[model samples]
Target: MRRTHSLRTRLAFGYGLFFAAVLVLMSAGVYWLVRQALLTEVSQELAAAAELIQQDFAASAGPLPGFFSDPDVLLKSLPPRLTELDTPAFYVQVSDLDDQFSIGSASLRGQQLPRTPEDQTAAMGGSTTTRIFPLGRGRVIQLSAPLLAGGAVVGVLQVAQSLRPVDQTLQVLLEGLAITGLIALVAAVRGGVWIVSRSLGPVNEITSTARQIFQAADLARRVPAASAADEIGALADTINAMLERLESLFTAQRRFVADVSHELRTPLTAMRGHLELLQRGVVRDAEDQAEMTADLLREVNRLTRMANDLLLLAQAEVGLQLRCAPVALDDLVLEVVRELRPLGEGVAMRPQLAEQVAISGDRDRIKQALINLVANAIQHSPVDGTVTVALDQDGESAYLRVRDEGQGIAPEDLSHVFERFYRADRARAQRTGGAGLGLAIVQWVAHAHGGEVLVESALGSGAAFIIRLPLSREQETEDRG
Candidate 1:
């Protein structure tokens, strides 16, 4: 959250920071131990000194100045310093309950005990605080006391110890802790930065490579696949796949646009040229004028048909509605055959239809598909070749198979037979005069009604196209509803 960090780097440094914080908390807890230990040693020494004073008073009931006359007895009665305390870091005082001075420690030589309410409030034996009794240079931990006689405090004893050693050790610990925390923080931050940069290297390359692609000039630019099977690699793979689909679509679109423009311009240019020549009196005779006018009219009709086909395709792309009504398949096939009978070799239609078989469809679109398929069969058939129109039901689908005795499509061109503008032999165009969208239109219409066109043929054998459509009253109602 602090800066740009990858998921990997963030997790690494977050754990590191958390680990360091835990150590710091543990170290802070040890500071309380230091305080407790200091107080325990101080209290132990106070208790020992109080015991010795009581013993001496028990041995001899005379009040001191005279009682501690022996220097050895006085030294033993006072609390001793231990090596574990590091130095003589404590103070001691001995006094009577009436504030009469007795003996005191070397550490408390220049300081006086408190005469305030805190000092006068007697403990059972001893009490302590970190409150200061002002000495020459600085402050001290003032330990105060009560000397018991039987069950009552008989005198007061006071001690004030320097706070210097504990404060010095605490200061050193704090400085050390600060330094350690800083080192850990820096290490965590730098490690996060490094991991973030390393993780983003692949993405940066993808961005730069994408920027350099010039697909407008050349329809192929793709991301290089990396070896690592990670999310980044998957992203690159997905992007490259999308680019492949885009390139295919764009190439097809370009070719289609070019072909359309060429087809439209040819007829348009001929019509324009012929009209201009006629207007300028270039054709004087009736015969010449009539021939030119006929050619112009033919071109005009061709242009109009082209425009209509294009509009049909546009409408089909947007999913044109199909009218649903009960139509007899046999009747539909015969009507399409009748319409195209005089067009080619009087191609005799051999009907093999199931009688009055009902099918759900739009009357016009189904009729159009049948007409296109029948016309195609007739156009491609040899003279006297029989074109068979067969209708039957296969399971839930209605089948209409158009089989013609014509030279079959080649193996190489068979797969693309339904493609728009695909001609098996370009040299054969003069005989048919087809624009090549007839089969494509048939396929599209069949598809619109939840059906498909299937072609089965071998070279030199006749071709049969099977159209299967759902034949049900419910299907018809749903399409209409």
Candidate 2:
């Protein structure tokens, strides 16, 4: 379904409607003001004309005789002078009280205006008044005033002006206003659309870029960033950041898969070779068969260890499931030191255990991390050199520091020590039969406990790996309690 209007259309329509309404109201107000002014001027002019006509009748005929008593005298004398005074814009009329006798401008000579309610009201001693009525293909403003003689009204005088010219003027004004309003409305709509389009252009670009990337199945593609400090710019930046993260994640995933495949294939290849040899009966004797079986078992164990390490790392990546408890840092460090001391061979295991050092964490994970660090130290330390396992605490944190006296990590390899399967030296890696995931696991365990593993070393100077964890609040509370 064509569910809704586009944003541009909606914006333009709403803006245009608002502008049009404002223009209409403005035009209406202007038209009303102009009409009022024109009509008021016409009424005032008509009043003045009516006054002058009464004066002309009273001066010219009232003194000569029965002008006040006879209606015919005032009617006859009024039209000629009124006609001479009349211009094309306005006309005059005189009528008796009975409304039967009337005389007016030449246009009204044969045409008789009706005795409207306003005219009768004027004749009945009301104040002077004005009214509008249609007359002969046009409209007129009619003002009625009483014609008085000896303090009594004998007749009514009306002055009317055709409103054609004024109406034409108003019509022209209306047309101009309408034209201007239309122009303004069009301009406003166009301008609003243009502005809205420009403002939304970035969002459109993001959408287009997203569609392109989705179609191409390319995580590396990104929306172009904008410098504008607007919401659109922010959205673009956010999308770009998301794309970057996705690209990084996918790249890492691919590399991880390749690495795992290569690593697992080695053991699988060895096991297959030995199995095929056994199937082909290539073993020369019982000793050879036993040796081959031992080799196969070794490969199997290696594969199993690698698989287990990968599982742990994968779980850590998502969020390691750790069983939490309060563990003594000093006790864990001493325990790891004791377990690793017998395996050190020519290397000496040293302990610098601090008292009452504790933390809240998974004890087994913490112990595993400590063992990994000490084992790594044992592997790296030179003959007769000391591998020191130390535990201490400051105000807010507990720390376990393991230092190995050996050729330390090179500067270039130091940063990558905790990366999966990263070996500082390949020869040592082969000699030690270590998978290089020990430090990585240690780092993971530290982070899982909301702590961090920090390393400091220099070539030939030895390396120190520090596991820092938050102090156990329970320990403090128990002591206080």
RMSD in angstroms, all models? 9.1, 7.0
Candidate 2, 1-481: lDDT as tens digits: 7789888789889988898899999999999999999988888878887787777666555544556356666656663567676676576777777776776677574676666776678667747878788988899888888876545676787878889989999999999998998898889899999998998788788889999999999987789888888888888888889889999888878877776787778778888999999999988799999999998888777777777878888888887688987787777777777777789999988899667777878998888888888888898888999999888877677889999998998999988899877888877875666777788899988888788999999998999999989888976665556
Q: Evaluate residue 323 in candidate 1 and report its C-alpha lDDT on the 0 to 100 scale.
A: 87
Give me the runs in candidate 2 sitting further than 4 Å from their true place.
17-179, 278-291, 476-481
- Residue 291, candidate 1: alpha-carbon lDDT: 96
Please tell me which predicted candidate would have the highest TM-score against the true structure: 2
- The lDDT values for all models are 0.71, 0.81
Residue 347 displacement (Å), model 1: 1.1
Residues 255-371, model 1: lDDT tens digits? 778767777776778888988998898889999899998988877776676677667777898987888887888888888777788776657888787655677779888888888
